[model samples]
Target chain A: MSAVLTLDHVKKVIGGKTIINGLSFSVREGEVFGFLGPNGAGKTTTIRMIVGLMDISEGDIVICGKSIKNDFTGAIKEIGAIVENPEMYKFLTGYQNLLQYARMHDGITKEKIREVIELVGLTDRIHDKVKKYSLGMRQRLGLAQCLLHDPKLLILDEPTNGLDPAGIREIRDHLRMLTRERGMSVIVSSHLLSEMELMCDRIAIIQNGELIDVQTINEFTEQATAAFAFETGSLGDAATWLKSDWNALMMEEGFSVEITREQVPVLIKKLTAEGIDLYGVKAVAKTLEDRFLEVTTK
Target chain B: MGKLIINECAKLFRRTGTWVMFAIVIIMILGIGAFLKYGEVNNPPQVNPAWEQELAMQLEADRAALEETGQNNATLRMFYEREIAVKEYQLEKDLAPETGVTLWSLMSEAQAVIGIIGVFTIIIAAGMVASEFSWGTVKLLLIRPIKRSKILLSKYLTVLLFGGLMLTVLYTVSALVGLVLFGMPEQARPYLAFADGEVVERSMFIQLIYNYLLSSIDVLMLATMAFMISAVFRNSSLAIGLSLFLMFMGGTGTMLLASKFDWAKYVLFANTNLTVYFDGVPPVEGMTLAFSIIMLLIYFVVFHLLAFFVFAKRDVAA
Candidate 1:
């Protein structure tokens, strides 16, 4: 897939201090790209630079084949973003807030606004003042605002910050649908590792304002060696031989061993040939959180 | 651009404070109208049959005051000279001052309400850019397809429009109230204006309208100053406080300085009342219309430069 957004050595300097240093990344079209970073690692700073909320001190950012610096209007026209929080005018109704944003862009009809409000499931309370809205409702309103003009890219920073489980799931499903069915690109930055694992196809991990790794979700979690716990009736007389052959360790009910997948069948056949009682074998998978901690700690 | 302006206006007019401001302007005009009408009913203005002799005595006293004005105090000397010239013209033309308050005269007095409008506009202007930051909306606002300068320009233009509306309301409602309370003058008398040592005739209606606009110069400058500070500092309270302080005290302070220092003519407040120059008095000697206009233009350009520069370049971390 072609890159929908590109950041080339993008840097942000404030008061002679570099906040974001030489960050380079590209987000592909029709992919939910996740940005994972520790607090104070400059994730929001990078996002702000992308959306022109912060000036880029060095390098260039291009969106949809247009440079943001030379052609800001052309580049920004393709993006819909919510930075940090969905801060809206509390005095205006949710619908009026959406209408305010809809007017900023071209060719957004009231009917289109209705469609977006429906998509975000804010149809019932869209006309209520935003001050009365709960955080979740404001989030839905923010999403509705983002989708009004049908932008090519959606950039949401901490989109699930205030959402409950159901709301986060609903947003994840929506992001998946938009990317898969409509070929739209999404850039999501969140501290929720498990959610990012479920929601993103790929994630970029940054630390100290530097890009550390960018890999698919599966690649990230699958690279570490797994421990397989074989639940059986004690190993019988074969316990000593099993320790010698497989380097097994004793457990309360079963023996746990670290091995590759291909060796599992061989070991199982040998155990059965020895007439050892075998009940179950399971691989304790390494979760994304485990891998994320492993990667970030390094 | 039009849509942006509409959005700004929508944000402004939707707030309760905005409507409250308009209501205050109207209620003030009516309140003063009622008070003046009460005074007129209770104690009528006495029309003296020897008004001509009274005018001559006043003119003579003005001449004495002019003589007492020291050679160094040119501003005071100019004030008395203009007074003497206008009174002399009234005496020679056999024109008598209207003893009773006329609608035009009441409206002129009611023009003090424009200062209230200036305060209201300053409040609006101070909050225009600063509130977005406080509300955490500037981050979303700046990420649009439009440029930052355009947004700031649209907001400043909205301030101008709001100020103009307030001025228009002050003028119109005051006229309306004055019409109800004080009837039109017995005969339409031209306003006597002393200019260049000659008293000139100007239609009272047109002259009042002209004064209404010219008097707004100070207000426009203060509003602009408030807007600039708000944009540069992103602090509404500071913007409001600083601008309001200047609005109330700047003119008097500048006039006091202008009495002592020739350099005070270059100050903002000294030139703000360009209407004074039209009425044949300069805050400082040798201050001309062309020179004041150029100074105002310089200040206007400088304020805009500082506002737009800081606003366009600052990061929207909020």
Candidate 2:
């Protein structure tokens, strides 16, 4: 797929201090790309730059083949973004608020507005004032707002900042459906590591205004060797050999060792030959949070 | 641009405060109407049959003063000359001073409320841009597929449109109340205006329309300044406070300064009241209609430059 959004060595300097230091990335068509970072990691700053809310100190950002600096209205027309929170006009009803945005665009229809409202499941409360809405309802209205124009790219900063587990799952499902069915690219930033792992197909990890690495979910968690917990009868006379040879960390039921898949069978046979009592074994999976910590620390 | 203006109007009119403002305007007009109608019904100012004699005496006094002054102060001398000419024309035409509150006179009296309209326009202009940031909706407002210049222009246009609306409301209501209380004059009395050092006869309706527009220049300038302050600083109260302060005190303060310094002609308030060029004496001597118009244009361009530059270039971090 072609790149829908590209950031070529983008830099942001505020008050003579560098905030985003030469960061580069691209969001492809029809993929849910995740922006993973800790607090104050320049995630919102980068999103702002992409949406043309802030100027880039250096480099360029191209959206839908249009450079933001050269053709702002043309580039911005292709994007539907929420820079920070989806701060809406609280005094206006949801429908009126949508009308406010719909007027800014060229040819958004009333049916289109209704379609987006229905898509976000806000049809029941769409006529109510936004000030009466809950946080989740506000998020849904915000989602409806961005979807009104059928944009080529959607950039959501901290999409799940104040959502419950159910709300988060709803947003995840909506994003996944939007990508698969609408053929739209999404750049989502979030502090929820587990949520990102479930929601994103590919994730870029950055820290302290610097890019750390970008990897697919499977590659991010997968390593050459895996850790296994070997449950056995106290290794009788085999404890000394097992500890020295495998560099094992002892656990409550047994000991865990890091080894290859091929070596597991070989070690099992040796343990049986030693006449040691053995039990079932299990493999431990490294979660995205663990990998995030490992990558950020390095 | 059309859609943006419509959207802005919807947002502005949907609020309750806007209706409350209109209500206050209507109520104030009625209150003034009632005060004048009931209080003056018992005794009318008896039209002095000798008013032409009185005007002739005043005209003689003004002519004598003009001869004795001998251009000691050019502006004062001009004022004396214009007064003498108008009084002489009033006597030559056999025109008597308005005896009491008439419909046309009440309509002219209603012009005092234009200052109140100016305050309302200032309030609306002051809050137009800053309220977006304060509500935190400027994030959504600026990210659309429109240029920042167009958006700001639409907003400024809407503020002017609202000012027009309020002026219309004031004019219509005052006319209705004035007609109901005083009724039309028995005969059409032509309004004599001093122009080019001579008194000219003009229709009252046309004169009132001219008065409405010329006085609105003051409101338009204050609203523009308030809009610029709101855009550049993103603070509505500061804009409102400063603009309203100037709205009330600017003329008086400029008058005080015009007495002491010649450069006071360069001040913005001194140039806002363009009516002085047409009928009355200018605050500063040697200040002409062309000079004031040029000064107004300079101030206007400066306000727009500051507003647009700061709005289009600044980082909207919040």
Candidate 3:
């Protein structure tokens, strides 16, 4: 996949404090790249810089092969974004707001507006003034406006912030469909790691303005060591036996094990006869949240 | 550019503030026109009768001089023709004072007061542009496929078009009101004068039209100033406040310096009343209408340049 957006050693400082220091990342075409970071980790700042809403103190951001500083119009031409809260003209109807945004782009038709409103599931209430809209509805409208330009890259800063479960699900589904249908790439930032895990193909985890890791979910899970746990008819015996066995294994091959529960057996006899005794055999799968905690903690 | 302008114009029409301001201008013009018409009815001045008497006396004196000379019939006819010419001149002069209170007169007064209305235009213009930022829709605005400069220009043009429309409505309606209230006289006359004693002859309708047009420049300048302030401040209220303060200070600053400082002639408000230049003898020396126009043009350029620079560079993250 071609790189739709690339930031190289980008740095930003405001009022003598560094917000993003030498941060680097690339978002590829047709990839749903999740930018996972805790609040105030400069995720919003970086996104703003990419979308040409903020100036970079140093370094470069390239969008669709155009430098943000040198070719802002060119870089922004195919980029759409919702930085932090989605802001709109409350006095204007949702459709009017969308129309205002659409006018900024060349060649957007009325059908396209209808298409976007439909995509965001706001068509029924599109003519209502935005002041009457719920936060989720406003968010959906913001998404519709961004989509109106048919941009190649979308930088959504905490796009799911403040959304209800249903609204979040709807947005996630819509985003997935958009990517699949239009081959549009998205860079989404959120404090919710689990949501990112479910929605994105790949995720970049950042802490303290530094990108700690970028990995596919499978890679993250696979690399995380699974806990080999078992239970025996005798809890004490299970603990001792497993400790000795796992300790030896650890010494020899670096494999690990732990006792989790005890169960009667047919199990001990069957496991001893087949050389596997502990009835409880469980290996913990590494969830995205687990990996996020480990990475951020580290 | 054309598309942006069209969109801006459409938005202006859609906005309720534009209509509200239009209604205010109409009310002001009609209210003032009505009051003046009522005043005219109650207190019809005495000069009109005095002017008629003066014309009659001039004609009678000419006839008496011819009789005293015992002139022949041909010479008496010559005297009669001369008397007719003097009578025509006197009648034209007599029409002058009445012309000063006609519909054109009210419109000219309205036009002069239109500078004060620039305050309203400034608020409207500032709000029109600054509300986008206060509402935080600038993000949506910039992301669209158009250049930032064009978007800013669209807003500026929209405010200007709205101001122009309001002025047109105010001027036209006020004239109609004046004509209805005070009988529409048959002949139009020039109401203003030149210091060199040269009279500018214009139809009342044309004078009213020019007054509206000329006042529009002040509106345009104020609108541009308000837009620039809105661009920088990004808040409609603050933009409105600061713009008004500056406009007020512009006049005050000019007044304070007009007597004390020779260079005060370069200040924008000091030179705003272009008619003052035609007053023949200027209150201050070395000031000309051409100079005022040039000064105002410089200010116009400066205001727009600041607006464009600040708007294009400032982050719209707010």
Candidate 4:
């Protein structure tokens, strides 16, 4: 896939202290790329730089092959972003806010505005003052505002920050649909690992202003060693026999060993030949959260 | 750029505060008209046939006083001379003192409302950029395809536009109220001004409009200062507090300093009241309209430079 955004060792320094230290990353087109990091880990800072809300001390950001420093208007024209919480004018109605945003870009007709409002599920409350809308409703309105320009890249910093379970699901589903339908790239930052695992095609983990790793969710989660617990009639005998050739630990009703899927049958046959009746065996798979903790903590 | 300015204007007009401010201005104008009308109905100005005799007596007293002490004070001498010139003109023209209400007098009196408009404009200017940051709407504004300078300029221009709108409302409402309370004058009057060591007659309507524009110079500068503060600090309270304080007290404070020091002429407050050069002398000696204009231009450029530079370079962290 072609890259939609590229950060060439972007750096942010404030008052002699480095906030973001030589961060480099690329977001490919038509993918939901997750930026996973803890609080104060420079996630929002990076997002701010990407959206041109903050200046980069060194290096440059190129959007759609246009450098932000050289051609700011050209680079920014293709992006729609919400840096943090979706804060808008409380005095204006949701539809008015959308209209105000629509005026900022060319060729945004009234029909396009209505279409985006409908897409974000804000058509019902679009005429209500934003102050009267709930946080979830505001988020949806913000989404509607960003979509009015039909941008190529959507950068949302902590999109699910103050959302409930249902709200989070709604935003995730909408993002998925947007990517699928429009072939738009998205860069979403969050501290929630489970949501990232479910929503992102690829995840980049950052810690203390440094990029630790970036990989597909399956690769990161499935790298953990798998283990199997065999329930045998003679647990003691099975543990004794497996301990010589394999790493085995005795349990209350079975013995467990760290092995792959292909080793399960051979171990069972060996157990039966050794006069130990094998009742059953179960495989324990590690979850994404477990792997995330392991990787981040290290 | 035009679209950005339009968007800014739309946002500004949508606020409840903007409408409330407009209501306050209209109400204030109406209240002034009512008070004037009440005064006109209750205590009618007795157009005394002996008004010339009374003016002659006052002039005699002022001349005597001037001979005694005005020689040492240039300001007192200038005031006495101008008063004498005005009285002489009224007597020579056989015109009674304009105690009766007329549309011309009402418009002249309504110019005072520009101060209130200045206050309102200052508030709006102070809140222009600062409120965007406070409301977290700067993120949306800056993320657009426009440059940051263009966005900032659009907001500043909108503030000026709102100020202009308020001024227009004040003029229109006052004109209408003046017509209702006092009938139009029979003929246009000429304003007596002391110029080149002699009394000169200037077109009254032209002088009134010029005075209005001159009075607005201070407002424009104060609003610009407030705009700069709003852009640099991004704190509405601080911007409003500092600019309003300067707007109300800066002139008085500078006058006090001018009394003690000649160098005070260079201060912004001393130079802000361009109207002083219209009918009265400047507070500080050796200050001329040309000098004040030059000083104002320098300050204007500096304020804009600081505001734009800081806004364009500063990070929008919040």
Candidate 5:
């Protein structure tokens, strides 16, 4: 499947300072792509450019194979976005806010307004004024608005920000359901790496306005280097023997020993043959957070 | 387009400020009407009868004085002619001319309240759209499916509609108030006169409508200025305040400037007031109704254009 969203050599500068420089990434159709970055990492800036809320200083942003700068409204027609904060009219009812957005897209019926409100689970409170709504309710309403137009691509910035655990779970499940049921592509950016690991099909890590890496969770885990851990009755003897003999043996056998858990079994068997005791063995698997920190830190 | 206009009108009506302005116009008209009538009832204009009688006696004495000095019959005829002219002048002076209707005369009963209603309706008309931005409704407005220019156009029309509604209420209440307070006068002539010699006499109701239309232009100017400022600053109070301040300055700024400078007449505000069109002659020698109108129109167009350009081109991301 072709990419639904693509940024090629995108650069944005404000007041003589570069906000995003030569950033590039693509999200495939039917993919829940999580864009992970720290605060002030230019995530919002990139999202704004994608949504046509700001003019791009350089490079092209293609939404569904259409350039946003050249074909803004046309490209935007197929993309839905909730940027930084869910800005809305405080005085209007939740339903009214959705209705206003509904009018922007052709063929959106009043019935569709009811449907989206129901989808967001805000039907009962849609008539309440937005100003009176809690932050979670507002976020849900904002999601409802983005979903109203039924765009093929959904771009959300920090969708789980300021939400209770249940609210965050609801959004996470809702987004997964949306992608699963409709086969829609979603780009969700957040600082919460664990949620992204759970929710996204693929993820891109960005740091300092640069794309550090893009990989699936499984590939990221599988590509991580295996570490061996070891335990022995005599810690000093084990270290001394390994430093001289095992280190050479493992290196010569096309393996690297880190004096971790995997070496415990080998050392025990070898030590028993040499009349020495072994106690324990262990192996370590890398976590998403560890991988994220590793990639972004560099 | 029609739906947008209707929606704007609906929003306009929903505003508490709109109701407040309407109430102010009505109360002002009624209050001014009652004050005029009460003053009229308690203090009828006192005519100077003594002066009138003295003038008449002087004319009669002049006739007698001229005849006594006549030398020939023809001379006596000339003397008598001069005496008759003197007597006619004195007789004319002795009889008091009928007094023109006062504010009380027009509104004490109900009809005069129309003029006062017209004034406040115009004031309210100026504030309608500017208040929306002041209240931060423009964000909700611009994000809708409609174009930006169309939004402003709808507001422009709504301001006029509001002016019409307020003016209607003003006219009805003033007429009702007039009928109740004072019986309808026999000569129901309109109070307005154009530059043409022809007098445009309207029924009290029609006069109210015409006067409202005349006052609406002031609101239109203010609304346009407010729209420009609202679009530029994107703040309602600033737009309303600046526009109103300019209007206030327009009324008296010229006079103050004239004391210090000879070019006061060139100021835009000094030329914006439509009252001068009704007042006999304008304060400035070259100032005319047509000139003032054209200048106001130019300002209106310029402000709207600036607003449109700024709104369309400004980076909204900030």
Candidate 6:
């Protein structure tokens, strides 16, 4: 698939300090690309640069094949973003806010406004002043605003920063639906690895202003060594034999060995040939959180 | 660009503070009118029917003094000659001498509302850009499909529009109240001025419009100053505080300096009041309307340059 956004050697230097050092990434069309990083890892900074809120020190960002430096208006017209908090005018109603945003773009009809409001499930409170709305409702209103222009790319920096679990789930599901139905690419940044794993098709991990790795969630989790636990009679004997032969370790109720999926049957046959009556063997899968910690800590 | 300006205006009108400021302006105008009416009702001034006799006496006394002094000073000679011309014209027209309040006089008095308008405009101008940063709404505004220059220009245009709106409200309210209290005059009068060693007469309506425009010069400059501060600092309180303080004290401070130093004529405050060139001499000798206009233009360009350059270049990290 073609990329909706591309960062070519993007660098950010503020006050003589390199905040983002030679970062490069591409978000493909119709995919939820997750940006995983700890606090102060240049996630918000990168998002800001992508949205043209801050200047890119030494590189260019191209949105839908238009360079931001060469054609800012042309490039930015294809993007809808909420950098940091989705701050809006609290004095105006959500509908008025949407109207104000609608004026910035051409050909946004009243029917489109109603459709976005309904899509975000804010049709009931869309007429109320934004100051009176809850944070989740504000986020929904922000989403409605981003959708008003029908942008090709949506960049949300920490979209679920202060949301409850239910709100987070709703945002995640809404983003998934948009990606699936509208075929619009989304770049979302978060520190929550579990949510990223569940929400994103692919994830990019960054640490200390450097891109550590970028891969599919399945590849990130399953590419690690597989651990298999074998529950059998004579657990101590099996543990010793497997430890010498396959470098096994003792588990709670069985002896565990680290091997590939293809070698599991061979290991099981070896254990049985040693006259160890095996009860069952199961492979232990590494969760995204575990892989995230392992990658970040390394 | 048009849509951005409209959006900015819509946001401006949506704020409660903008409406409150408008109400304050209207109430202040009404309050001034009522106070003047009350004063006139409670303490009526005695008008002398034989004011011609009084004028003859004063003119003779001024002539005797000029003779006694030998009319050595040019300024004093000009002053006496202008006073004599005014008194002679009033006696010739058989007009009452400063008798009762007229609609024109009330409208002239209502010009004091310009100062109040200046305060309100300064408040709006100071908060125009800074409040966006404080409210965190700048992010939403800058992420739009338009350029930053268009965004900032649209905001500044909206501020000027609000100032114009307030000025219109002040003039309309004052005119309406004056009409109700002091009926319209049967004839339009001419304003007399001492120019080129003789008395000159000009149309009063033209003079009134000129007065309004001239009086608004200081206000426009100060509002622009406040706007520049708001854009550069992005702190509404600082912009308002500094601009308001300068608006109130700038003229007085420049006057004090003008008395002591000739270089004070070059200062912004000394050149802001373009009205002085019309009716009276500038605070400093040798200062003319063209010079002040040039000075104002320089400051105007400089302030806008700084505002636009800083707003466009500075990173919106917050």
Model 1 per-residue lDDT tens digits across residues A158-198: 99998999999999999998999889999999999989999
For model 5, the stretches where C-alpha displacement exceeds 4 angstroms are A225-286, B3-187, B198-200, B258-263
Q: How do the residues B121-202 of candidate 4 rate in per-residue lDDT, one tens digit apiece? A: 9999999999999999888988888778888899888988998899888887888989888877776677887776777788
Candidate 5 per-residue lDDT over residues B1-318, each given as its tens digit: 666766666555644666777787678767766776787688776756576666667767767656675434443434345445544643554434335344325543343444444344444444444454454444334433455567667666766676567657766666666666666655544443333423333454555555556655655676567767766776666765676676556657777785577576666665655655553335565566787778777877897798778766554453
Model 1 chain A: lowest-lDDT 10 consecutive positions? A233-242
Error of 2 at A195 (Å): 1.0
lDDT of 6 at B110: 76
Q: Write the per-residue lDDT of candidate 4 for residues A1-298, one digit (tens) a residue.
A: 8999999998989999998898898999999999988788899999888888888899999999998878888988899998889999999999988888888788999999988988888877889999999988988888888888888999987888778999999999999998999999999888787888889999998888889898988898889888898887865555655787888877888788889899888888877778887788998777777787888899
Q: First chain TM-score in every candidate?
A: 0.88, 0.93, 0.85, 0.86, 0.84, 0.87
- For chain B alone, what TM-score does every candidate structure achieve against the true structure? 0.91, 0.95, 0.78, 0.90, 0.68, 0.88
Worst 10 residues of 1 chain B by lDDT: B69-78
How much is A227 displaced in model 2, in angstroms? 5.0
Once fitted onto the true fold, the runs of candidate 3 whose alpha carbons sit more than 4 angstroms away are A226-286, B44-47, B52-96, B99-101, B112-116, B190-197, B280-283
TM-score of chain B of 3: 0.78
Clashing residue pairs in candidate 1 (N, C-alpha, C atoms within 3 angstroms):
none
Query: Candidate 2 lDDT, tens digit per residue, B174-284?
Result: 889888998888888888787777788899888888899899999999999999999999999999999999998999999999999999899999999998766677998
Clashing pairs in 2: none
Q: DockQ of each model against the real complex?
A: 0.83, 0.77, 0.44, 0.79, 0.23, 0.79
Model 2 chain B weakest 10-residue run by lDDT: B70-79
Q: What would the per-residue lDDT of candidate 1 be over residues B46-85, giving only the tens digit for each residue?
A: 9789989999999989888888873667767777888888
Model 5 per-residue lDDT tens digits across residues A116-212: 8899999889899888999999999988878887888998889999999999999989988898899789999998888887889898878788888
Which residue pairs does candidate 3 place in steric collision? A104-B145, A105-B145, A230-A280, A231-A280, A271-A276, B195-B280
Give candidate 5's iRMS in Å, 1 decimal.
3.9
Q: What is the CAPRI rating of model 6's predicted complex?
A: medium
User: What's the C-alpha lDDT at position A124 in model 1?
Assistant: 93
lDDT at position A86, candidate 4: 90
Candidate numbers, best TM-score first, in rank order: 2, 1, 4, 6, 3, 5
